[model samples]
Target chain A: MAVSVLPQMKQAPEMNPVERLMAATAADMARVNDLILDRARSHVDMVPELARYLIDSGGKRLRPMLTVAAAILFGRGQGHAVNFAAAVEFMHNATLLHDDVVDESDMRRGKPAARMVWGNKASILVGDFLLGQAFMMMVETGDIEALGVLSAASAVMAEGEVFQLAKTGDLETSAADYAEVIRAKTAVLFEAACAVGAMSGGADAAGRKALALYGLELGNAFQLVDDALDYGGQSGTLGKNVGDDLREGKMTLPVILALEAASDSERAIIASALGKPDATDLEVHQVVAIFNRYDTLRRTLDKARDHAKAAIAALDSLPDSEMKTILADVVQHSVSRAS
Target chain B: MAVSVLPQMKQAPEMNPVERLMAATAADMARVNDLILDRARSHVDMVPELARYLIDSGGKRLRPMLTVAAAILFGRGQGHAVNFAAAVEFMHNATLLHDDVVDESDMRRGKPAARMVWGNKASILVGDFLLGQAFMMMVETGDIEALGVLSAASAVMAEGEVFQLAKTGDLETSAADYAEVIRAKTAVLFEAACAVGAMSGGADAAGRKALALYGLELGNAFQLVDDALDYGGQSGTLGKNVGDDLREGKMTLPVILALEAASDSERAIIASALGKPDATDLEVHQVVAIFNRYDTLRRTLDKARDHAKAAIAALDSLPDSEMKTILADVVQHSVSRAS
Candidate 1:
């Protein structure tokens, strides 16, 4: 069965819910981030040099930005939302640093990884430091709901990574398992980012639910397309090499489905390739060829579009606002953008 | 300038404070752990598996046990001290798993490292999962004071690892620098554990400070003796391999002093030895002989004794209670034990 891609949002700038929501509260969001970075200075002094090294590396600040954006979408433009956003970003960065160490990865955002430059121990500990900072920041917010949401999301994120590790080389991973992993590892934070934003703004039940759904769907769309791009060349768009996931032995959507449909010989090749810790680039190329033969890349792209459309539908239930329109643009970008 | 070892408390079975404290909170602590673990089931299903892998791996669970002991000692035994203890233990294990991955260590507690068993990614992510579990457990305690203390301590622990990494193999590291590292990496948690225990038991400011100091000194003593035993080669008492620190290129108390006191030729030899992390056991033995010649091992052991006495002194201002007295005994054990 072929799935249709969502048409690109041509009037996205004018109609995007996320953009409208963000435009309304961009200044406050910036202020909240400044406050967070200021407070982060206290605990960060223990490794002043390294902490500065990472903080200066420049991040997208997407999680916190989304948190603030969600708050504005819910008609809540307050400082607490910004604090929670900063905390969310801290948690995200902590994981990134730790992940880099665990993966023995050398680069991040075209720069040397914290571990590569500072050594693995520094990266690992600094990651832990960021996590501690996150909790402390959340506790000070004094919102039991926010604390519950963030902490619970963090637990899921950790669990998701462990689950992914356990299943990485296993070709038997199903679409459901893949979906669950994305939810646990990525989307839950997105959901919480919006939920916390709504809570901070004191949104109505409908508003809260709508923002949560929108964030989840958007995250799903983003990760699904990400998985697909690894099977096809999308470096110009995604800023990463093609077949990176296969090289990492990740049982992502295209690979999982393609393997399911593989001929006996193809299956044997994949099974052997997946078993190894470091699969060769030639093996990755062979896997990508199998994906192409099965139209696996196209199928995954279709799923991503479905998720993006579902995300847009979620916003349809919310009060029509500028922030809502920007959100629509975000969903559009999730499946369409290169990087 | 021989440093005298603290006399080990020669008490009857009934006089064993560690055992007594362990017994007092054993059931409640276990039950509370059940509660925290239950909450984790839906959020972190992989945790039960990972926790079993780690907890069954023969770790002493010393930190959590001390937390419970401290709670009982402070007379605030009715609350979530057990969960707090469990949280601290989880944090400690997280560090262990990540540390093994960072150091590329093959052995822990006389067994294979987690990375060796499950691979680096699994070890790292599982470590992260344990940390998240710690945070989740802390959320259940619902005490901001306890939350703040643990959070700050966690950050210090991370920073300490970075500082330690940065200073590793550097001959210029001072005693003050070494002290700061241990304090951040190990003692802060010990201090926080006791402080959280006091908070749990509703202990006053004075009581909390006293216990915190006691734990801090105990940690310092413990680390100092640990370093000394690495050089002293009193294997019967230290259980761990002698000069393991030197083999790992770790700069410890004896080595720091030895470098300072060495003749220029000897200093160059030491520096060159540290350059090769893959040094043979014979090479390690050669380094130990050098330390022996300089009396660096003896001097370091003396310094450890001083810290042990200081640890006991920190408890002197506390109220006269059996638990308090037992805590003092533990402080002495901190220095006297071989491993």
Candidate 2:
């Protein structure tokens, strides 16, 4: 419950690139918190209660900071970058509220989710309000091109949510199906944030395309890692329990791919575990053990690493800058985050 | 249950002056039914079961017809009026789906609501998908001003929903509060549609302003009439029972205003009916008798007339054409709809 405020340039732990990346993320996230988020939230008190409640509950703020970093990398580091950055963050929170209602999630970021605090109806409406506000803020940019990207991304995000709703709990789902879901649900906004920043900063079409590619790959990797963690990572480190995805009956990429490669007996056990009215801890442990023997975690991590590398490759066209380094660092960190 | 198609030239008997003005509205409504609503629902076959479940249950396409009539009157008589009109209708449907979930209503338009058929979670997500699609359709307009106005209105509508959530079941509501609620809940988008149509047609600032004014007044009157009817409109006519609003504890305009005007004995009776766990038919009848004695319905209808006149006044700046005449007719007809 104790919140710590650490300096930006903290030392990295040995043997884990995650520490350095977390430290960088912490620094960048802090700037967004201090500069834009806190200020915008305070401007309107009543509704911002939920916005701040969701935002400050220890989210990575990776998307908004990426927008800022992208702007800086492209040599237009000031002006609407912060605003657009907040807009992206708001969009993320909006999705989270609706997702929690849809998923019936009670906790998020180690705190009770919005639906838990305010009920599903409030959470849903507030989520809608946040999305609208995000669009309104983006309109202030006066750049129709940016508007087009963000609006389209917003549409894609909603579609992704519906797609997930349609697909979740279905045993027939494949890794490709999961990939499609993740790409729309999580990655598109990240891609939009970076692309909008590049385009807004006057990046050429090729540069904007490259940035978008990097963001998409990076976001995909981040979600892949998240899916893997949901399947096997330590609860203490991950902020979620291993096998949470199974209990929720969600067929994430790792689970689907692992199921594809599992032996008949393993698949039977997995299916039975998923079919439980309320999956018991022992059943979850059994499924986890099967996944462990198959090295599903390792395979998932490797795929995530490949995506991260692809993200880095996408950034090769950018002129070297502090932000570019940070952007690349974010991709690595995204894949490595335990939570 | 049988519907008879009426030609524009041959008006129905009960049609008033406003209905006469809105003759083209009837035709436009039919056009919308064919070109947009039917096709839009047909495309829902992609989801097959869920789509069939939602669209097969009928909905009144009031919002879209309003848009079409306003657009035509405001000089947007050609080029994708159907699309924009459908966009508004889609928005209306989206709101209805979400409202059913929030209100936990079982029936709408004489059948099971979307949530009742598919579950609240699906209805909520599909509502979101519909809303997103509406935005996409609006974007297809390529009118920045139109986008801005609709986007702003959408935001207000979301905020209104939130406001309603925040105040739900609270009996301390006032007439002014109720007005504020309706303004956000129903009027803004109506205003935006007229504004967008005028703007699209290259109407001057005065003309656009007039259109907006007309929309605001008409929407206000329409909502007021709806609330009044909800209090006592015959089921055979309005397809709704009297006292449904009171039973739901909606705190609508007539009830709020009526409560303020109630004598001490009347207030006690009204309070008892509202406070009861299940208000009996006799209790509702008593409340209705009190309302009739207080002339609450007449007062509300008078206010509606004032708004109707104001909407007509707002359109005075537009060039006099058949479409303009029809738009004016819509205002009169909207306030007088029996069902």
RMSD of 2: 5.3
- TM-score: model 1 vs. ground truth: 0.89
Q: Please give the lDDT score for candidate 1.
A: 0.74
Task: Please report how far candidate 1 places residue A304 from its true position, in Å.
Answer: 1.8
Q: Model 1: DockQ against the native?
A: 0.47
Would you list the clashing residue pairs of candidate 2? B18-B332, B21-B329, B22-B329
lDDT of candidates 1 onward, in order: 0.74, 0.72
> What's the residue-level lDDT of B312 in candidate 1?
80
DockQ of each: 0.47, 0.42
* Model 2 spans with C-alpha error above 4 angstroms: A1-46, A77-79, A262-265, A275-277, B1-60, B77-83, B236-241, B263-269, B272-278
- DockQ, candidate 2, vs. native dimer: 0.42
Tell me candidate 1's interface RMSD.
2.4
Which candidate has the highest DockQ of all? 1
User: How far off is each candidate at the interface, as Cα RMSD in Å?
Assistant: 2.4, 2.7
Docking class of 2: acceptable
